[model samples]
Target: MTKPRVLLADDHRMVAEGLKSLLAEEFELAGIVEDGLALVKAARELNPDAIVADISMPNLTGIDALVQLKRDNPQVRVVFLTMHRNPAYARRALQIGALGFVLKHSAPAELVLAVRAALEGRTFIAPDLAAEVFRTPAKKEAGPAEALTSRQREILQLLAQGHSAKQIGAALNLSARTVEDHKYRLMETLGIENNAELIHFAIKHGLAP
Candidate 1:
């Protein structure tokens, strides 16, 4: 029998290496990407049966990347592997169509189980987070920060990470002027006036760590 195709996305080189080993036996490795933007591109090209991604990633977050991917391939399964224990993140992942939300600290077996559940069209949350995922009610309205477009949020994260417009542009394949424009618009939307304030806003709103 053919193994399921899996795409892996995470910024940490060591973590990606570890997952590659663990997943090798159970799934056909489609490709591995270091950031969310690359993950989206790779997923589109590879058309994997499922994706395992980290929530906090550069260029675009896993959730945002998955959002874009779902627009074109809604049947693709995604299981988020995140370091965040925050129930809010888990709830958001599920709400955005992720079938699994496993914590980074979870046992390796749990990730395998999560992947299997996702492939079978079932939902899986880390045992510790399962209760919280269910206990949380659906959000009726988008949060102020959530109102930002995916591109805006990506630029905001780079800004919060202290990347200059030129660096951010190079990273995302946008022009420096475009990066600057996005920064300005994000700042205006959030009512922030400067880089310091923008960084603070991103942290407070969980746009960046």
Candidate 2:
């Protein structure tokens, strides 16, 4: 039988290498990308059956990238493998259509299972997080972070990573002035007054790299 195609995305080379080894036996390794932007590009080009990604990648976060990917391909299967143990992150990921949320520390034993489940159209949350992730109602009012547009969230992630307006503009194909305008607008929307608070908010809400 042809193995299921899998794409791996993680900023940490060592972690990606290890995941590559773990998944290679059961699935075909379609590609490896180091950041969320590259993951989005590779997923488009490769059309892998499933993607194993890290949530806190640079340029764009995995959740944000998935949001964009799902816009074009809603059936895209993704399993997030990350160190973040916060149930809120897992909740947000699943709410956004991720099929699996596995913690990095438990990956050796759980990742393949999660990937398989996702490919089979099943949802899997790490055992440690499953209880808390599902304890709350499925629907909730949008939080402050959820209120930001996708472009604004992208710019916020870049800003939190210490990129300047010019660099961000270059990356997003906007002018520096436009990038600055976006910065100010997002700040006002979030009710934050300064860069330090913005960075703190980003980190707190899982928007930071």
Task: Give the per-residue lDDT digits (tens) of candidate 2, residues 8-123.
Answer: 99999998998989998999999899988889889999999999999999999999999988997999999999988989889889989999999988847699999999999999
How many backbone overlaps does candidate 2 show? Answer: 0
- Residue 29 C-alpha lDDT in model 1: 90
Q: Model 2, stretches more than 4 Å misplaced?
A: 137-142
What is the lDDT for 197 in model 2?
Answer: 98
Worst 10-residue lDDT window for candidate 1 reads 136-145
Residue 153 CA displacement from its true place in model 1, Å: 0.9
Q: What would the per-residue lDDT of candidate 1 be over residues 1-209, giving only the tens digit for each residue?
A: 99999999999989998999999999989988998879989998999999999998887789888888889798889999999998988888888899999999989999999999999999999998888778957657877787898789888888888888999899888999999888888878888888888889888988785
* Model 2 TM-score, 2 decimals: 0.93
> Which candidate leads the pack in TM-score?
2
How accurate locally, in lDDT, is each candidate?
Answer: 0.89, 0.92
